[model samples]
Target chain A: MNIVIIDYGAGNTKSVQFACHRLGFSPVLSNDKDVIRLADKVIFPGVGQASNAMQMLKKSGLDSVIPTLTQPVLGICLGMQLLCNTTEEGHTQGLGVFDVAVKRFSNTLKVPQMGWNTIFSLESNLFLGLKNDAYMYLVHSYYAEICEHTISQTNYGLNYSSALKRDNFYGVQFHPEKSSTEGAQILNNFLTL
Target chain B: MLTKRIIPCLDIKDGRTVKGVNFINLIDAGDPVVLAKEYAEKGADELVFLDISATLEGRKTTLEMVLKVAEQVNIPFTVGGGISSIKDVDSLLKSGADKVSINSSAIKRPELINELSAKFGSQCVVVAIDAKQIDGQWMVHLAGGSIPTELNLFNWAKEVEMRGAGEILFTSMDHDGTKDGFANEALSRLSTELHIPIIASGGAGTIQHFVDTFQIGKSDAALAASVFHFGEIKIHELKENLRKNNINVRL
Candidate 1:
């Protein structure tokens, strides 16, 4: 399978590639639209500022290419946030793949809500075979509010959309690559889809 | 709310897991990959690999071990010990480590933290501070707690946070390997003072110690080595105890 990892100059693609290799798949890290479009699966993984990431994507013209993907595409962390209509991280606009906006966690609790948290309300095949409320790792200051496309929800000060799905596009706010066994299982599930 | 974390630290030397008493009298623990996999399966929230090797050759072996462990384990892994520059951090992270921790080097050049956090978000930079109490003040130590610096623990912690470190891994040289308890007083102070997460390290002997560190120390995570390596404390039972204690730990 040609699993392409969207590499838009973010410094967080190594682990994602390793995750793919561990799951018995060789992933190609590329910014080329043709390669990404032709792949069996594309993973948009990132852990950086949205404004700069969007700028890079725009400069490479990947901003237009990403939304056109018909194959199963998974967006992780900042990549997930970039799939929304807008984000508060850098006052930047997103691809609008899902009808939602990313907002910063309220100051009432610790920001960046990092560490292992449980995911409930599992509704998609992405969580196939996994127990409900399985622990997955997360680290971010902004979160996507629950929306019509949300397939799973997690609570950290407030319940937010931990996972979202719109047709062939899927997104997870957590870092499944860094998350343990169940996380690896989720990646396998995505691959099977 | 995010659940409290239970991190098992593995001190590696010559590519083998090792444990020491108060930073002395080292003994072989086990294979890091095996132990790490067991810890993750038993519900360890994360794993920290600290290379305590003294020679340059040994550090290279540690990197290879990191590659092996990363290929097998699926948990978030942090690699520490002798990380001096961005190149070192790059190699380790590229080798599949989720985070790179720096200690004495970060102290010598505080800007290293800024540079690292700039290149690879603060989430990837973990500044580890090995501290010891001297003259009624908790002072930062260097070279694995052998050399004392003028920097105070609390002051250095705040400085690291300001410098863009994502988290601070505070190890009490006085409390490490003592098996009595953690430095909750200092851990609590560090927690209340810093905005970022504080990982309380050293002196975790019992399940009650874990409870106290989370409750009294107000630590975001608690890390221990010997008790876990020696099998004196099981990860599942410890987490069960924490859950029973009303602490929100992932089971």
Candidate 2:
């Protein structure tokens, strides 16, 4: 499969590519529009501030290309957050693929809810063969609220959308690549989707 | 629920794992990548690689080790030790490290915290504070707890959080290497006062100590070196013990 991980200067793309490599696939890392469009599966990964990432995306015109992709595109972490309508981080507008607005976790809990958390209420093939309340590694301050596109739910201080799906575009708040075996399974499921 | 984390810290020197690791079924015990993969399979929530290399060549080898570990290990890992600038962090993260922990550099120039957090998002910047109690005052220390600073622990931690540190890895030098227990009093205070997650390091001899750090210290994660390195406490068994203690662990 011609797998391309969109690299718009956002961090963690190497880890994502290595994850795909460990799964026996050598995924390409590219920011070019045509290279991404020609991929059988596309992985969009980001791990920095939202507004800065959005700016980078807009600079490369990927903000427009990403929303128009017909292949199964999996957005991980900040990549996932950028797919939403908007995010509270930096008051940035997103690519508007999921139709859900991302909100920051209240200060009552840790700002960036780090470490392993259980993700449940799985409703998509992305989590196929995964158990309920499966632990996925998450590190983010902003989360998309539960919506019609939400495929799974996770509780930090409250129930929020951990995974969202809207046709070809799927987003996960957790890093399936860094989430160990079960996470690898989810990545495989997405690749095979 | 967000479960508590059990982190096995690997100290690297000249591209080799320092302090003997006693894990069985290993051709090379000093190989950080192999040990990292073993720990991940054994149920370690996360891993921390502290580069204790003294020379420039050693540091370069440490970076290569980071790349190797990142490629082989599936779980999240942090690379720390002598990381001072955005350039250093950028290379490490680009090499596939999930996070970079800064110590003395952050203390020397507190703005480094703000700068790192601003550039790399708070989630990727971990401010590791090594402090010890001196004359009933918790004072921050530099150079692996050999040099002392007048800055108070709680005050420094508060500043770190305000400066946008995603997490604080607090190591009580007094409790570190003792295996007595974590500094739960100071740790609980840090957790209560700071909104960011606190990772309790040092003083981890027993599984119960792990339990105490999470329940009493209110630590989001616990990091230890000797017990895990010497294979005195197995990650899988330790987690089971934590689970039995009603503590939320990954298991």
Candidate 3:
């Protein structure tokens, strides 16, 4: 499979690539429009501030190219947040893929809800073999509020959309690549999609 | 609910895994990649690699070790111990380290925390403070708990949070390597004072210690070395026990 991981200077792409490598797939890391456009599967991974990442995406002209792709695209972490309508982080605008808004976690809880949390209310094939309340590694300060596109919910202080799906695009707030076996299964499901 | 984390810290020297009792008398454990894979499979929530290598060549090998571990291990790991600049963090994160923990560097120049959190995002910046109680006061120490500083543990932790640190890994030098328990009093205080997650390090010998650190210490995570490295406490069994105690864990 010609899997391409969209890399626009976002961190954690190496770990994502390594995850794919462990799953017996040699995924390519590319930011070129044509390379990403022709991939059998596209994995968009991000870690860092949202506005800065959106800026990088715009600079590479990928901000526009990403929304138009017809293949199965999986956006992980900040990549998922950038697929929403807008985010509270830096008041950054997103690609409008998921039709949701990202809001910062209230100060009552830790700003960045780090460590392992359970993802449940699974509503998509992305969670095919996964059980309800399966643990996934999450590290994010901003989360997409539950919306019509939300396919999974995780509770930190409240129920938030941990995974979303709209047509061909899928977004997960957790890092499946670093989420051990169940997470690898999610990535494999995305690949086989 | 977000579960309390069980982190098995591996002290690295010259590309090998080593464990020190009270930060001294290092003993070789095994190949880092092999040990990391074992810990991850055994249900370790996360891992911290503290590179104690003093020579330049050893540091270079540490980078290579990070790369290999990232390639093989399917869990998140943090690379720390002598990271002092953005350039160093950049290389380590690029090499696939999930986060970089800054110690003496952040103490010497507090701006380094702000700079790292701004550039890499606070989620990837972890400030590890090593402090021991001195005459009824928890005093911050530098250079792996050898050099003393006037900064109080609570005051420094608050500043770390204000500077935009995503988490604080507080190690009680007094309790470390004693196999008694964590400094729950100090840990709970830091957890209550700071809004970010606090990782309780140093004192961890039994499963109850892990439970106490989570329940009493109010720590989001607990990190230990000898107990786990020497096979005294098993990650899976410990997590199971924590779950039985009504404490949420990844197990």
Candidate 4:
């Protein structure tokens, strides 16, 4: 399978590539539009500020090519946030693939919400074999609001969409690459689909 | 609620784990890759690798170990012991380390914390503070807890947070390796004084110690070495005990 990891020049794509290789797929990391388009599956994974990531994505033209991906595409962390309509982080605009808006986690709770937390209300194929209330690793200060596309939800002082799906495009607020066992299973499920 | 993390730390020397464990099921006591995979499978929330080797060759081995562990274990892990610069942090991160912990080097150059945090974001920087009670004051120690610094423990913790450190791994020199328990008093003080998450390291012998660190110390995570390495305390069982104590843990 041709698995291409989008390199938007922000987050570390090494771990994501390593995760895929562990799953028995030889994944390629690239920013080339042709490489991304011709791939069987694409992974949009990133870290750092949303504005900077969006800027990098636009500069490379992956910003436009990403939303147009017809094959299965998974967006993780910053990549997932970029799929939303807009984000309060740096007041950046997103790809608008999903109709949700990203907002900073309320100060009533911790900002980053780092560490392991459970995800429930699973409805996507990405969670095919996973049980309800499965724990996943999360590390971010901003979260995508619960919307029609939300396939999974998590509670962290407030309920938010932990995972979202709109057609072939899938997004997760948490870092499945960093999450142990269950996280690998999620990636496996995504690859199978 | 975010659950308190139970981390198993491995002391490495020349890419091999320094602690010789005799767990019957373990593949090899000194192989870091084998031990790290075992810890991850056993439900450890995270893993830490402390490279005790001070040689140039040993640093390269630590990087190789980081690559091996990051590829095999699908969990967040931090690397520490010899990291001193942004280049070191960059190399380790590029090798797949989720975070980099700075100890003596951070003490020598306090601004190293700021530079690393600014460049890589605070979440990627973990400042490890080794402190001991000297003359009734908790004074920071350096050079693997042999030399003393003028920085007070509490004040240093606040500075670590202010300087953009994502977390503080506080290891009490007095309690470290003693196996009595974690220095809950110091840990509690650090937690209260600092807003960022505090990982209580140093002394952890039993499951109760983990519970005390979480409940009493208010630590966001508990890190242990000998206890976990020797199989003296099983992480799954310890987590079960914590769960029974009404403490949230990933089971």
Candidate 2's displacement at residue A191, Å, is 0.7
Which candidate has the top score in TM-score?
2
Residue range A80-156, candidate 3, lDDT tens digits: 99999999999999999999999999989987899999999999999999999999999999999999999999999
Ranking by DockQ: 2, 3, 4, 1
Model 3 chain A: ten consecutive residues of lowest lDDT: A104-113
- Root-mean-square deviation (CA) per prediction: 3.0, 0.9, 2.5, 1.5
- On residues A1-193, what C-alpha lDDT tens digit does candidate 4 reach at each position? 8999998778879999999889898899999999999999999998877888888999998888999999999999989999999999889999999998999877666456779999999998899889999999988888888899999999988899999999999999888887887898999999889
Between candidates 3 and 4, the TM-score winner: 3
Worst 10 residues of 4 chain A by lDDT: A105-114
Candidate 3, DockQ score (0 to 1):
0.91
- In order, the Cα lDDT scores of the candidates are 0.89, 0.93, 0.93, 0.89
Q: What is the DockQ of each candidate?
A: 0.64, 0.92, 0.91, 0.66
Candidate 1 Cα deviation (angstroms), residue A179: 2.2
Query: lDDT score, residue A43, model 3?
Result: 94
**Model 3, span B27-143: residue lDDT tens:** 323688877887889899999999999998999999999999999998999999999999999999999999999999999999999999999999999999999999999999999
Report the candidate with higher lDDT, 1 versus 2: 2
Lowest summed lDDT across 10 adjacent residues in model 4 chain B is found at B19-28
TM-score of structure candidate 3: 0.97
